[model samples]
Structures are given as structure tokens and as C-alpha cells.
Target chain A: MDRNRRVSVEEVKHIAELAHIKLTEEEETLFTEQFNRILDYFSKISEVNTEGVPLTYHVLDLINVYREDEVQESLGEEEPLKNAPKREDRFFKAPRIV
Target chain B: MKTGGIEEKRALSKLYELTAIEISEKIRNQEISTEEYLYSILERIGQVEKKVHAFVTVVDEKALEKAREIDRKVRKGEKLGCLAGVAVAVKDNICTRNIRTTCSSRMLENFVPPYDATVIERLKAADAIILGKTNMDEFAMGTTTETSYFGTTHNPWDLRKVPGGSSGGSAAAVISEEATVALGSDTGGSIRCPASYCSNVGLKPTYGLVSRYGLISYANSLEQIGPLTRTVRDCALLLSVISGHDDRDSTSVNLAQKDYLSFLQDDIKKLKIGLPKEFFEEGVEEDAKGPVFEAADKFEDLGASCHEVSLPMMSYALAAYYIIAMSEASSNLARYDGLRYGYREENDEGDFDTVFSRNRRIGFGAEVRRRIILGTYALSAGYFEQYYMKALKIRTLIRRDFERVFKNVDVIIGPTMPVLPFDIGERIDDPLKLYMCDILTVPANLTGYPAISVPCGFRNGLPVGLQIIGKPFEEGTLLRVAYTFERNTDYHKYRPSL
Candidate 1:
């Protein structure tokens, strides 16, 4: 592996475009340097031996935190709709749904 | 709006050292009027919140009314609930009836829940005054408050730096005395990380110990609501009020809890505390290690035994945390269609593809959109095993590492973060670096163990936190150790002069 391999300015711009963050040209230059340094810090992790390890997704030993099957009164329809920024009667309004 | 500023700050200041339990005793004995305590803190919120930006909403009318009702009960010689008159802040992610629950995301910038969260209902029954909803990361996705559509929350200790986030605003509020305490949701160190940076105590209870029904999901399996406070005893008090079996959250544990304050008095005489070798490393700032070791030394002086333990899988904790968190996030956030709740933008330019893409492109922030896309790609049929499944396996190894250590030790101690709070814009440019910020606290989240970040000492004039990891449902032991440490050091009492 080429340890000195570096991503170019254009490549950083391409990633910024992909991420949809409207970055300035200067931001592209800054991020390219920062991203490389971050990858260097992160490369340290791959050196660890993770063989035969089971991936743990959640730590809580709880299998199920089920509540009794019962319905409670909703806070009423008007209360929620009242706070909507753009609502037309019972429903919230949006620009276009087509 | 004129809340007797000077008188209120002084009275509320007196109750700052008192736990919700102790405050209730004072309220019962008529040492302080309920209105006097409530308004005093509300006045302080008014005085400091403009600069701290700790609260997103302040329900002054509702809080004042609740105080008057409590006063009426007292005059009638009626009994009050355990947390009566204690002022608390809720993270904007937690639902509250008649209050906007934005989750700090523009997608739901104007969304309001139709009901109260289970914990909110309990707090109300106990007569706890709901000051307002505090700020958080947009959709609880980022580490810094910068990701919020509203704005970034500055660290109270040092305004230019971030309060480690997505719960940054809540932690900042408690540190600045904007509110006595606040509730924050943790998924992979959101609570503990920020609590450490802001010099407050933040607890991420074992995943199912607290209900997640009202908390907007970030990573469903990893999220837990916990308290962030200025002291360990207050954190214990907050936990006592929030922990219980909740039918609303399918995964909430029904474990019995004793009065957590009782644990503070218990002896630490023969308890074994583990210090993981992987935690103390070259990447960690040299200054942070001193306080961590100093805290360990204090524990030894308190008659507890400390040992070095190995958690080899911890090196991958941050990577695993991101993969799993993003994968779950991609799935969890899919519900926020332009149809159900929140903002909607029209795409008149093209066909179905343009329309769908445009909606998300405009609605979500750069970080939120990045995680969603990454998660969606990772969980795609072809990549699940390579990314998501493999991450889960690493997670299990991490948990097993903790279980193995816990077999011999009552608690595990370490630095909350590798470095202290960084400047606001420092890591935002590199997503990977931002994710790396949670390295020290992620293992506890992966394994479902309860961990807390307590104000232990200072470095370069800023506070440093000591993190303690406890076995499941052993919050009592965690509190006792933290309280004992706080008693030994004046770290918790050192409020920022700002």
C-alpha cells in the first residue's frame, strides 16, 4: 500500500458535491488536508486483531421491554395541528405533493 | 416576564447543592416557598439562557401555574411527590404535549407531539416543573451542536469551544445553571461525551433502564434517555425519578431500584475497579491522562482496589459505533416522509426521481444526509454482511470484553474523551474525525452497560471528566463511586465564571 497516496483537490470537491454541502473552493482545499489527517488517525484501528469476534449491536441485556397491550387517549387532534407552521384545518400544508 | 431576578438566583443557588430529595425536604418544611424556588430558577434561565442558548423553549406560564398549584397543595397540608418543585429541562428530542418537539432538525422544525413522554408524565405527577425543551443535534445525528438547524450550542466553560454533543445544549444548560438539571438521550456517547466537555455529570443508563418511547430515535438499539446534572447526587436523584418499567417502551427494563441516594453512603471498601489498557494511549492528550490517573488514585485512597484490564476490541469501537449507528439511523429516519409530519418542498423541475431526491436534498442537513446515504448503502442487500453484520460482530466482542472485566471488577474507569472540547469548526470538515471523538465512551454504549461522565478535574483551566462503567442495573454502584469521588474532589462544585 502506498502510505503517501494523497487525494487531489478535485476529488475533495467531488465528495463535497456528493454530500450536497455547498463548500467554497477554499473549504475544498482545507477539507482535503483535514480528511487525509483523519484517515491517518483512523488507520491505526485496522492494526487490531478482530478475528473470530462476534459483533455486538446493542448492549442492553433486555430482550423485550413490552408494555401491556392497551390504548391511551391521544392528546386530541386539535392540539398537535395547532402548532403546525403551515396547516390547513386538520392537516398540515406543504408546497406540492404531486 | 419579570421574575424577580436577584431574589430568585440567590434562593435557587441555595438549592443547587441539594438533591431533588433534599429540596423536597426543604419545600415540605416551608423553608422555601414552591413559587420562590421555581421563579428563582426561571429568573436565572432568563438571565443566562440568551447567551448559553441552552433552552429552545421556555414555558414560563405553565411552570408558574404549576408552582402556584404546588403552593396551594402545601397550604392545604397535602403531601407532595418526591421531586416536587424541582426544575428540569427536557431535550428537544423528547416529546412534550403542546410544545414543539423539533429534535433540532429542520425536517421537523415545527413538529409538535400530541402527547407527553412517559418520563414527562412521571415528572409532572411528582410536581417537577418543566422549564422548557433544550437543544440537541439535528435528529440526534452529530457529536457537536453545530449540526442542529437552529444553531450550535457553545460550551459554558469556554464559549468558543463546543459542548460535546448531540446533547450539547442540555449539558451546557446544566453547567451554566440555566436549569438545575436536564434530560438528554444518549446513543453512542451523546450524553456522556457532552457532559464531560461541559463539566457536568451525564448518565447513559443501560439501554432498557429508561424508556425510549418519547425520544426520537437516532440509532434505535443504542439510544437511552438519562440525566445530565452538575453533581453526582443530583444525577442520582434524576435517575430515581426517570427509571421504572414503562409499558410505552417495549424494551424498558422492569428491574427493581432502591433509593439511589442510599447508595451514596455505602462503603467502597473492597470494590474492584477496572482500568482498561486500551483507554490510556498516545492519541489521548497527555493532560487528560493525569486527571484519569488522579481519579484512580483517589479511588484507591478511598480503599477500592484498581487493576489494569485489557479490552483489545475497543480499538474498533468508534468504527463499529458509526457503522451500526448510521445503519440504524438510515432505517429509523425513513419514516420522516414529507407526508406524515414536518416541512415539504416541491420539485417542479423533473420526474419522480428528481422529486424524491429534491425533497431530501433540501430537507436534511449535510451530516444527516451523509449518514442516511452511508447507512442505506451499508444496509443494501449486497453490503450488509461486509459492513453492518461485521460491525455487529465487533460490537459483541466489545461487550464480551466488558463482561469478562466485570466478572472481577465492580466498575471500569477511564477518560470520557481522548481530548477536551475542541473549537466549534475544528472537526466538522472531516466526518471521520468527528466520529473518532467518541472513542472512549462508545464501548459502554455497544455493550448496553450504564456509564457516567463526572467532573473529575481540570486541564488548562477547563474541566476534565472521569467516566465510570458499571454492569447492567448497577447504577447504584456507579452513583456511589461517583458521589464518593465528588466528595473527595471539589471538581463538581467549580462552576464556570461566565
Candidate 2:
């Protein structure tokens, strides 16, 4: 097991790619150190005796937050849109969606 | 009455009460000019904000323009809305049209929303001045404001101590008079914690009461936007303006609100207030507990009965909150791809991997990235059942614990935070130490109940927030009890000499 190691720059780059983030060289180096330390800390979780203990995620026991299915009126034209750099024909024009 | 010997009249003239209802009344009666009020607050911000660091971005030009428009309308004898020309500091999480809504994360540093958040639209419609975007824990993840990409907000009461977070900046702004009132989002005591630390009033409106359309989601199930002000009346007034159903947010409840401020005047006789025994147990700070008990004494003076109720699982709420909040946050923050919106870098080298690699790494902060990794691991395929599902079941138990207690009491009183405000760097090195600060306030979020943190008393001259937890959608009763406490005590009126 390669336990005595910091995450490689290559590995950090890979993780950053997977996470969809752009990293500067400084960030990659910084996160590599930080991530290694964090991963080391997370290793403590494995030490807990959970032979029968269930892994818990959400604290709220809510089964589902459901709302009654109903149709509602839209704001129609009464809605006044403000703080736009530009607007056109009751719609906010922006950079192409595609 | 004199603040710093600057003359009582000057201090009073400079003082901004953080409620739309009060501001509207004054604006309508021509008691104060909107321009006078707006610039006066801006000047106050300039005076005190250096140490407090309450705002991430101050929209001075826009805020002044909005105030001037309100002044113009008032001069023309136009009918005023509910909160004409009131200055409102928005939490960085909520999207503001053309305004950078960073959520205090590096991810959205340059991202400007193309449209106003629903609450922003509502606040603007009420003729409120958008003061600025206040700082927070990056993506509303931490209990202390230390997790912010912009750095921590100082407690106004004590410059060295922290204002509770991730709504710390908002609470500090209100306390230091940077803005009259500020909008804050609470997933797990973000609003209340800061409000408690800063000696201000903060409310976590019942889930679905306030529209969450434009709020940057930290934890979808737990998040609700509310106000942090200096008085309970301001919270009630803000609630009336912001709480309503919106088509954009399907989870919004269409329930009608009676005048919450009117409900504040109701008699407190025969009201059952629960004192959770588990909260006051050993490990609770002696200083914090003393003020909490004093607050309980005040509640008793208001003709309300206080009884100790047992919530055995309440002890594990902080641990459970972190697990659940991080898991949800990991999922919610996945949207900031840096491709569509928020700080996207130009990647001329064309691979999809390269595009994502350059974008997210530069965009997100260390805390956000850490949580994302933690959440990803928790919600991943194999660990889902062991971690996420089990937490959900325990969450049920936590909620049941509150439900059982609330059945015997109309409200529960406890310390909003378990300790006095720690200095800036006290818990920065230890993440677990930071997470422990939410011990007293996470239960309300876990139970999906409405809780308020109002100024109780001072502990060594620093502010203490007393939390009033009520049943779901029973914000009226919570406000009534809080208002009663505020009216009977001078705790809310205590201003920092700074």
C-alpha cells in the first residue's frame, strides 16, 4: 500500500479536471498539500467501530417534502424587471445560451 | 443617549432602525429624507466597517440612486410601499441582477446574475435600497465566518472576536450600522449564529415561508432566507415583505400571514416554554449558560411556564448537521462549472477535461473544495446506504425528538450559541473545533422548525443570543416571545462603544 505519499501533481490535476475546476500552479501545489492533509484526517473515520453502526447522512428524518400538485398563475406582464445591462421585448437578452 | 459624545441628536439622526415597517412610516410622514438616511448609513459604514469588514461589495452608487428615487416619489406625494427607501444588505449567496453574488466563494468571484433573485425583486418593489452584498462562510458551509474566501467578519461588540457565520457579515453590518437590516440565508444557524454573536435579531423563517428562488443553495432541504436585525419587530416586518409563494420556487408555501407585529402584542399568559435539559448539560460554557438561565428567568417573568424537556438525540445534532449539510452542499455546488456562469477562464486549448480543470480549480475556495470532496465520498454509490440513508433515518429521530417536545411546549428556549465569541484565529487551524460552534443551533435546522436568536444579555460585554424555537410555520409565536423578551430587557439596545 502506498500510504507514505502525498497526492502527486498529476493526481491533483486529474481531480481538478474531474471536479471541473481551473487551477493555477500555486493552487495545484497548495491543494496537493492541503488535500493530502485532509485525506489523512479522513483516515480517522476508518478507525471508528462501525460493525453494526449505520452510516448516517441527513439529520432530518423527512421522508419526502412534497407539495400538492396544482397549477398557479404566472406573474404575466405585471412583473417589472430591473438592473439589467440590456433588455429586449420583455425578455432579458444575454450571451447566447448555446 | 449620546453615542461617543457626538451629540445625542446626531447619534439618533445617524442611527438606522433595521425594519422596513419603521422606515416606511417615517418616509411616508416625511419625518426623514431617504437621502439623509442612506448617506448617513454610508457614512456610518465608512466609520466602523474597517474593523468589522461586514461587506464583500458595497453598491454605493446604486444604493444612493435608489434612495434618491424614493425621495423623489415621496416629494411627488406618491403612495409608498411597505418599506420605502430602507437600506438592506443582502447576503452574498442570493443572486442580484448585475451585482456579483459570490456566496463568499472564489468560485463566483466575477459572476454577475443576469436577473434579480425573487427576494431582491420583492425588496426592490418595496422601495428598499440595496446596500451591498455581505460576506459569509464560503458557500454557507461553516458555522463561523472564518471559512469565507473574503476573510472573517469581526464581532462589532468585540473587535478581536468573530461574528458568527456564514451570515456573519450580514449580522455585523446590522450591528455596526453598515446597513439597517440585512438578508441572510440559514441552512444551519447561519443567520441566528451571527445574530447571536453580534447581539442582533435573526429569524430562520419556517421552510417554504420565504421564497428561495435566487438563494445560492448550500443545503437545499435545510436552507431558508430570513432577516438579521436589531429588534424582533424588524424581523416580523421583514418577514411580511419577503414571505410569500413564488412560481419560480415550487417549494414556496402559499399560506397567508397575519400581521406578525400585531401578534407581538399578544398576551404571553399560559404559554408553555420548554427548556431542553440536554442543551444545558456539562460542556456548555458557564458564561453562556448563566445568560441563558437569566433569559429563562425573564421568560418566567412574562407569565410563561418553563419546564425541562429531554432530547437525548440532540447531543448528536452537530455531527449529523455537518454530515448532511456537506453532503447536500457537495451536490448543490456542482452547478458552478465555470462554463455557463461564474468565473470561467478562457481555455483556448480545447479538450473538455482541460476546460473543467482550469475553471473549477481556480474558481472554488479550499473550504468549498474540501466539502465537495467530503460530500462526494459520502453520497457516492457504496457509502450512500451506510452514510447518507442512515443519517436521514437518524434525522427523523431528531425531528421526532423536537416534535415530541414541542407538543408539550409552545416554544423552546436555549442559548443560540454554546460559547462566547472566539477570536479570529482561534479555530482556524482545527476544522472540527469550528464545527462544534453550531452545537446549540443545528437542531432547529435538522427539525425544519422556525428558530429566532434575539439579544439576551452580554457575557463580559460581548453579546449573547437567546434562541427561541417554535413549531413549523409558527413564526408568529416565536416573534411574540422574542419581542416580549426584547421589550422587557435593555439587551437589544446595548451598542458597542466603537
Candidate 3:
């Protein structure tokens, strides 16, 4: 475990920003300490000699599976938009980005 | 000449005590109506739900309607499915059509899916009555069910202690006889952990063996929906109903299905069971270890051979598992941005990023936010190679380690959890310390091997689980071994006095 690798408040804020989450001042301070400890525990992976090992993204022995390009009856627009917190007609309403 | 009230209560308790298989037989033979069976379970739930807090929502009306339909079909002499008339509770993380599947989080508190999960469809096809949704850790994140927004599910054996989670409610439901069987998803020991703490049987099927089509993804690559039941035979029956190919889930294998119940022979003669030394070393409590070793001796007495094996790379499995799971969770949980389904902040009339951030901040709990933040950091540009990639490489090594060990031994056996059920709120604040409890169970999830947690013994009135890991898609072997141990021991027979 490397002490130099401890996460800082700035890093925690940046990570939260990237994760689309807003943290309060108290939460930011709390996460800074918790992240450092958890990351320090994760640092143990560096000890393993994985020099020639390939990264396993998935455990199954499957490749890209292609389904037939057939039009099928799926959920209607109303069904999906039913749970939207704010929906205008059939489309989900969101804050303007531009 | 006992009191009528006491006699009636005893009869009802006896009815609730019958195994799912026996109840199904009685239903099929017209000795008991499916409606009566369901009423008995619902009655018991009404009795203990306040103490246990096992269910997030109980679909009383819908369950009765379905039970009546099954009973009507039974009276007509029509064919019934394998699980006909059985009461099955599903973890809230798995989607249910027209039923609110809240994943124990406020984020999806009012969100109802328009579709059922593949396993739910299978259970419906088997005529299994869906009792209701069980509580869980919010987004299946915590080891104990305390993180649930609904409330913590108490361990049936001792209400003060936690039933291990994130499938805590499902395991508690079974142990308390609220439901005959349950479906729980295990990202890293969610099912087995609760099963251990509750003294029930849970199986995490080999990845891709069971379809994950409708399971709300906590970690897409690491989690698999599994069964939790009071008996190994019921576990196998539930597995048979749910296991198979689904084109909807691309990762699901198109393997031939077998009647898992047929593998329940009491004979493990000439079987090769490996006792991994890393699992039983220091950190494992003596109370938890004693029963597991005794179980190994029991296997040896049953004419099976037990050997001490080593999966040295297992020491790094916890690190690798959390890194991978949290990274995946950060990505999977990014969909709850207030625009689509889930909780939303209506008054946020700011920029898109502000709305998204605010929605998530208010929607997610502390643990979920922590994992999402850490995961984003792990995958960040400068840190990807150092954290995320390193964890994946270690995952490869862990997989290879299991592959190498499986060639010599048919199965690896060890304690499911390193400690007995801790008092609720003991480690809730210390997230890192809480993660340590999963050390022994995460290796199977990392390697995509099938594993099961069966009650082996008790410690100071709390239960200990023995975990058996088998080769990929070799759940038959795992169930066979579990069945043997369960038959030879009376550990699973001890029910909570609640």
C-alpha cells in the first residue's frame, strides 16, 4: 500500500463531478478519507505479476452475438415514458444543455 | 384436549414448515390448495414481518389471485409447472413487470418496470407464485441490509444482528418462512453472504449459466441471479427453472439444460473436495472454521477425499473484485440522471450537468455515491492503467488460478463468510472494514465459477456457512456436494424461533 497514492479532496470532487454527483462540503471531506483507505486496500493488486496476462473484461467465452435484424413489437412509447419524472407528450423532458 | 387456539397455531406452523417440494406435491395431489398454501405463508409473514422487515413490498392481492388461478387449474386436473403453487420472493433489484422493483433505493422508489426479468418470466412459466419484492442493500452495495432505504433486514436467528446482504431480505424471508424460495443476485457474495448469516442455502450460478436479462445491473460482468432456499433440493429446483439460454442476454450460454434435482444423490463417494488454505488462514474466526473443518471430516467419512489446496492469488481477489465491480457500477448506475426513470429534481432549472449532478446527489445514498466516485477515479485518464487495468489483469490471474486448481480437484470448499453475523450498525460506517468480510466469497465471483453457501454449524447461536466452488457451469457438482453435507447434518433443520 502506497501512502503517496491517497486520494485528496480535490481528486474526490473531480471524481464526483465526473460521476454526475454533487457532494456537500461535509460529504467531500468524508469521502476524501474513505476513498484514501479503500484505494490503499486496492493498491495490493500491484504486487501481482500480471505482466503477460490479458485483461479480462468478461468471464464468459462468448464473442459479439448478432441478433437477426427483425422488427419486433417492443415496449410502446407510452410504457417507457410512463415513469418519467417530467415528460412532455411522448418524450422525456430535460434541462436545456446548449 | 389442548386449547383450540394452540392446536390451530401448531397446525399452521406445521404447514409453514413443510418444504416447497412437499407443498407442491400436496397441491398437485389436491390435498392442499395453492390458495391455502399461500395463505399460510402470508399468515406467517403477517406474524413476523414487523420483527424481520424482510419485504419491501408484499403483493398480497396479486399473490392471492395467482394462487387462486393455480388452484383452479389444479382442481381441473390440468398440468402444472415444476414450481406450481410455490411461494417465491424476488430481490427488489430484479425487475418485475407492473410491480414496483425499488432495489431498496429511493432513486427507484416509484419506478415500475414495463417488463419482468428473464428469471421472473421463467418462474411465472413454472407457475411459481411471486410473493413480493424483498429488501436489499441500496443498489446491492452493502454487505448488511442496513443500507436499504426501506430499513435493515434483521437476522432471523438473532434480530439484533444483520442478515448478511445485499440479498439480506431474501435470505431472511426464507429463514423466517415468509417465502418458500427466493431469487437474489450476487455481484460479490450478495446471495451467499445473506444465506450464511441466515442459515439458509444460496447458490451463485456460474456467470452466463443463468440469464441476467431483467436483473438491474449492479455490475454487469460480475453479478448473476441465483437461488436462496431452506433446502439444497429447493435450491436445485429453483435453479432448474431459471437456468438456460436467453438471446436477450448476449452473455448467456446456449447450454443443454439438465434436471438439477436428479443430481441430489446422497453419495459423494470418491468425490474430490479441495480445502483451500488461504480461505481458512488467520482472519477466519475459530467459531466459523470449526464447523467447516468438521464438514470436511464429514466428507472424508462419507468416503470422499479432502485435500489441502492453495489458491495463493486468492489473497488479491478482494482488491480485484471491488475495483472491477465498483468500476462497472459507476457506469451502470449512470442512467439515473432525472431525465429518464427514477427520482428526479423538478426545481433544478439549471444546466444539464447541474440537473444531473443534483438528481444523483439527492437520489443515491452514501455508499452508492462513494463507490461511483471511486470508480470514476479508478477509470480516469491518468489512473486507468494503474487502477482499472491492474485490477483486470489480476482478475485474469485469479481466473487462471481457479482453472489451474480445478484440474486437480473437483471442487474447492471453505467458509462462506469469515465471521459470524455482526451486530447491525457495528461496521456500517466503516466501509473498508465492511469490505473485509467478503474476502473468502469474492473469489468465485471473480473467476465466474459457481459457488453455494450451505449452513454447516452454529456459533453462539449464530449460523456459519460452508461455501463450495465448482468449475464453470458445473453447478450439478456443487449442488450434489451441498446436498450430501445437508443430508448428513441437521444444521439446516434449525429454524429461527421468531
Candidate 4:
């Protein structure tokens, strides 16, 4: 929330990790500079007093949209799994977690 | 009616220039076969596509085959759908079964969806031939089409200038007569900006009016698949085909289905139009303002009331839009890991984090990566309240501003874009300057209002669009107003001279 706080390179690296994006050293520096400028522009939002304004998540005022929980045909396992980089019998293969 | 005469050739050439409604009428009356119509459109594409670069993938053979199928049905005296045999260029973000639906990004270059989007299903049901997937900004993330990974789509009016984006290719295709009509997604003016630049009629329907089942998510809340065509009636016809209830998309509203083309009455009598004063202030180009104000005068001439109104919160709309869009994008794009559908690293030797990060780094373009990172920062632990939370609050205020104004005015009118199309690569490197182009257009997205951008007139040899925004789900009024304006002016009739 620091008004004039600049995004340090270390913070940029941390954020890239959180976003699952691997940045080269060059990208790190570029992002730091761009972030400072873009965030500085966004900081102007603090000037407005939104004291009692409620946050709007969706524009439509519809509440939870419910549907019948009946079974319907889906893209059988093979069609969707066809695009996976690595797949086992019928599932996507990923590296071991442990 | 000589077969090889010059007059016959000219008459046949004019067939490709007709609007979708006219084409449908001709087809119904047996005046033109679908095969003949497709041939003329394909000939026009051959003539102008090299200069425009509007399509990422042109399904020429498949389209011809589909046209032939429709022609056979016509010969059998069967009932035809509303848009039978109409050619439509779809923005690449919407998934098409077995077609390479890249969002003009390298990540999904080889990925093809197994199923069609709800909109595509509806289009197919209506017998509209899928022309091809059109070019777009990478992941629909940038203002100008310059950020497209497949290469920039040139504005048909001037090949050197950019077609405003992220739906630039759709706009350019309709302008250059490459397609009879096209579909484009608008999140913060993607459809309207390019429509303004390419001199076409583009509609961004109310948030949930059209199903988003097959659209590749950019900002889930702000984006909607809409139509871009050379005329307002064509826009409405396409909208009617693709809109309505779809349980597949949980957000799609089940509003009573209405024939949008029926709303295209050329009457704006007693229609109240509000002109936001801030949209005409300092940064807007004088040339762009001239056409908009003149269009408003024309509306008054047609017996409608035009008055200046103030929306003070509009100044903050641009910043709020970026924050909310980026935050949503960050979350939506997290599915692009090496393990799943999209681009994957070849080595495959690293652990999960390493593979995921490397895939994202290599797959996504620079702008997409930058927005994702900025969004991640905005939603991070210490900064969430400062950036994302405040942005949501401002969004509420902006929506309230529109609600309050619409109490007195049936619709609001302004310039779709503050300036004309710029030279390609003019503002690509400067991200802030590029973001400023959406200043006037984002308020509609923020509030999820239905808005249309229609070509008003030319400025400095380029086209200017006058935007008409209606109350939420009031697309009928918006289309009617735009249709009336088209009747009064010849701006929409001016071809790009490609």
C-alpha cells in the first residue's frame, strides 16, 4: 500500500514465482521498470473516496445459477487427453509430487 | 443479362458487397446459389487479403463444401435458417471443433479444441459457413493488433496503419469485404476499437447476453462474444443467431429470446441521448470529435434529444479496468502448465515448478507475461487491499454513475476511440500510452452495458466511430439508434478502397 513504493527486482522475482512464470534476468529488470510506471499510474485510484461503495464482482445481479445435476455426456477421456503433452492410460501425466 | 458481358460482371461483383440480410433474401428467392455467393466472396478475399492480413487461417475448401451443402438443401425446397450460407470470420479466441483456434498466440499454435463454443454451435445451427479464424492480439491482451504473435493485421484503409485491436482482424475483414460478417470478443473495447478504426458496425452485447462457453478466457467478467459487420442490420442478425440461454455457460442469462433484427427500426423519435463531456476533453483528437458531434446533431435533426451529461468517475475507469482485468487474467491463465493442453517444454526433465515456469516463459508473449506478473503483484498478500480491492470499489462507482445517468437518458453517445488509427508499432513499446487508447471505451465494459460503435464519418481520410451505449440488456434500443444514424449518413457506405 506504499504510495510511492517502487517494485524492487527481488519483489518482481517473487511475483513471477507466484504467477508460475520464469523470467530471465533481463525480464526481471524490464518488469521492475514497467511495474513502477504502471503501478504509479494505478496509484491515482487512492485519490477517490469509495467510503461506502460495495465492491462489484460481476456486472449482472444474478445470484448463484443452479442447473439440474443430471448426468450428461462429456468429451470422453480420449478427446480431451489427446492434447496433453504426456498422458498415461487415460489421465494426464505429471511429475511426482513427493 | 449476357453471360460474359461487362454489365453482368459488374452485377456479379456487387453481390459480394451486399449485407447479410440482403444476401439471405437473395438466397431465399433463388436469385443466387450459395456456391456462387461463396465464389464471389472468395474472389474478394483473394483480391484484398494479401494487403489486409486479416485471417490467421482461411478454411477455403471446407467453406466451399459447406456452401455446396446449403445449396443442395435450397434445391430440395427445405426450410433455411436465418443466416444460411452467410460467411463469418470468427476471432481465434473462440474454440472451434477440430479447427486451429489460436488466440494469435504461440502457446496454442498446435492446439485444436475437440468441441465448439456455444456461439459456434448456434452459428452452425443457423447454417452460417465458418470462413476462418481471424487474427487478434495475443491472448486478447493488447490495444493494437501489433501484439499478435502471427504478425500484425494491417488496417484495410491504410496498410501502414494498425487496425485497432484485440479484435482487429475481425474488423479489418469486414471492412475489406473479406467476409460477409464476423464475430469478435470485446473486453475493454477490443471489438469497438477495431470497429472504429476499420469503419464497421461492432456490437458488444450485455455481459451475459451471449454465451461464453467456448471463448478462451481473457477477463472472464468483462468479455463477450459479439458481432462486427458492415451494416447495423447485419450486426443484429448475427447477434440474434448467437445470443440466448445456454446452460453450458453458467453465466449465460436465460432471457426471453428476441429477434434482434426486428429491433432495427429507423426511428429515434423521443430517444434521449447523453453525451459525456469528459470524453470530448483535451486528449481527444479534434478530427474525431467533429464526426461525433455532427452525428449527435444529425440525431437531433431526426427528432431525438441530445444533451451534455457529466460522469465524473469516468476519469478513473481506465485504471480500474486494467487492475480488474489483470487480476482476472492472472487467475484464468494459470491453467497453461506444461502438463496440460497448451504449449509444453520439449526437455521435460525438470520438476513441476521448473517445467511450468519454463513453459509459460517460452509460450506466452511479452505483453501477456507482463500483465500476468502485474496481476499477481496486485493480488499478493500485502497489496491486495491497495490495488485489487480498490479497483473493485471503483468499478461499483462507475456502474452506479452509468445507472444514475441512464435514469434520464435512454442511451449515451460518444466517440468509440479518442483518436484515429496510428501507424503500426507507434505505441506498442509504450504500454501506458497504449492503455490510454481505451480511456473512453472501458466504462461500458466496467458496467457490462451493451454498446455499439458505428462509422459516423471520415476524419483526415480515416474513419471515426460514434459509440451508442444502452442500459444493460437493452441491446434493442442501441441497435435501433445506430440503424437510424446509418440511414441519415452515408459514412457506413464508404468502402476502404482496398
C-alpha RMSD between model 4 and the true structure: 2.0
Who wins the DockQ comparison? 3
lDDT tens per residue, model 3, B308-377:
8898898889998999899999999988887889989868678999988998998899999998988888
Put down candidate 4 lDDT per residue, B1-498, tens digits, no spaces: 225678766777777888899888888789988877887888898898889999999999999999989988888999999998999999999999988898999899888899999999999999899999999999999878888889999998889999999999999999898899999999999999999999999999999999999999999999999999999999989999999999988889989999988998889999999999998998899988999999989999999999889999999999999999999999999988867688887777668888888999999999999999999988999999999999999999998889899999999999999989999989998898999999998999999999999999887789999999999899999999999999889998899888
Off by over 4 Å in 1: A1-55, A60-98, B1-19, B346-356
Model 4: share of real contacts kept: 0.81
Candidate 2 lDDT over B86-170, as tens digits, reads 8999999998987888888777776677678889998988888899999998888777788888888888888898888999999
Q: If both were scored by TM-score, which would come out higher, candidate 2 or candidate 4?
A: 4
Give lDDT per model, in order: 0.79, 0.78, 0.92, 0.92
lDDT of 3 at B255: 94
Sorting all predicted structures by TM-score, with the top scorer first, yields: 3, 4, 1, 2
Name the 10 consecutive residues with the lowest summed lDDT in model 2 chain B.
B1-10
Candidate 4 accuracy as lDDT: 0.92
When only chain A is evaluated, what TM-score does every model earn? 0.59, 0.65, 0.89, 0.90
Better model by TM-score: candidate 1 vs candidate 4:
4
